[model samples]
Target: MKKIILLCLTIVLYNCNGNAQKTAQKTEQKAYKVSKTDSEWKAQLSKMEYYVLRKAGTERPFSSPLNKNYKAGTYVCAACNTPLFKSEHKFDSGTGWPSFDREIKGHVAFGSDNKLGYSRDEEHCATCGGHLGHVFNDGPINTTGKRHCINGVALKFIPKE
Candidate 1:
């Protein structure tokens, strides 16, 4: 009975490890519309941008100038220049990041992220699959009530001409 229980525990542990590895591999294997080699991405983006966009890393809060920007412009994907959020949709969430009440239609993609030990709706640039940030439900009630808390490094602001 002891041997049988040990074998069962070992099998469960192995399966769990395999699943974790598969998840990592799947992330690596997934391709986006604007695929680039690691070298290409590194060459095209700054070190901070590369970390946020390619490695799915988050930037320090209050570190982005766009957080306080209130200009009339469009926020676009830093990687592919895809328009994401318009100036009108931006709001002062006070989260120290650029928060948007909404995204441009068809410009962003959603996925489940469990990195924080809870389910979070992660947003990414649809064109380049760069990690933008996460969305939350606690937003202005007058609007969509969705806060797209994005990494400023993942976007480029194009002021209206």
Candidate 2:
């Protein structure tokens, strides 16, 4: 029994890496076409926008006026003005955030986020690496079946001309 207990303890200790985490935050980040200094981003974005786009924070549900906006326009990255979701893809998800069925292909990048314990698909502006939000499998069946639940502050509405 003593030997068995010692073996178990050794195995547990061996599995740990001196408090280092096994995953989540990566050592190096992918390069983006539009990069800016921390100060620049803070200066350009509003307080709430900075929180959502740069800090990966969520805004209060139903707080964003864009949530109920039904205008025909394009949604661009608030950080870099990169066109992301089109007006045609926008949908009222009843989720309080500006939801979209799809993004302009190749403009948005996908990453893994396990911050919520379970894994979630993370979205970012491919050009600026701004935190847009998460994408889920739940969406219109006739469409792409992707619900890109994005933060409104992370986006800017551009009316069609």
Candidate 3:
């Protein structure tokens, strides 16, 4: 019984990989306009921002204050300050996090996420490669038909002047 248990544990440990490298791996091969060392990122970002951006971790739904924001402004990358989304494209997806109908052209990048035993469309900042969040097809009609569900921690809103 002990031998079998050990074998099972070994197999589980060897085959099941965590989501730790999910974002990092995706950014490694692609170069971003704004690059920073891990230490630099940690020093600059808050703990929650670091977790959501660098580690590709998800923030709790409806937890972000930005989710309810409806002001005119722009959402920029929290890590690199790269402009990503506009308030005009924002919407209430009710899935929490800040949902947008679209992104600022050329500011966001897309990738694949399979951490949940299925495939998901992941998004990140094209400027710094910071993990933003995932995009889904279930969005408002008569528009882009794409929901860019982004992590608020990964963004900082700059009100229009």
Candidate 4:
């Protein structure tokens, strides 16, 4: 009985490890409209921007000035300047990052991310494929009820003139 239990545990652990590896191996196969070489991207983006946009890194909560920004304007992709979230959809979710209820139509793309040991809807720039952030269902009930938590380093705030 002990041997059988040990063998079953081993098999289950191995399968779980393999599944995690497989999930990590699934890269973004689709090409973006504004693809660039690593060096080119490094040259165009700041160190922090490169880290968050290219490496799928997250900024510390409440670390982005954009989180407190309430000016009216549009937020564009830091990499390719593609307009993403509008100021109208911006909200304060108090999650320490810029929160939005919606994004510009056809500007942001969604994909499954299991990097944090759970499934999350990851957002990226449709034009440059830059990592933006994650979206959650807990948002303002009167609004779209979607919280688009974005990294400030991944966006450029273009204030309305």
lDDT of 1 by residue, 44-149 (tens): 9999999999999999999999999999999999999999999999999999999999999999999888998999999999888999999999988999999999
Consecutive 10-residue window with the lowest summed lDDT within model 4: 21-30
| Global Cα RMSD, each model | 2.5, 2.4, 5.4, 3.1
lDDT of 2 at 106: 98
Q: TM per model?
A: 0.88, 0.88, 0.83, 0.85
Give residue 6's error in model 1 in angstroms: 7.3
Tens-digit lDDT track for model 2 on 130-153?
Answer: 999999999888999999999998
Question: Best to worst by lDDT, what's the order?
Answer: 1, 4, 3, 2
Per-candidate local distance difference test: 0.95, 0.91, 0.92, 0.94
Cα RMSD for predicted model 3: 5.4
lDDT of 4 by residue, 119-145 (tens): 999999999999999999998889889
Q: Per-residue error at 18 for model 1, in Å?
A: 4.4
The candidate that wins on lDDT is: 1
The stretch of ten residues in a row with the least summed lDDT in candidate 3 is 15-24
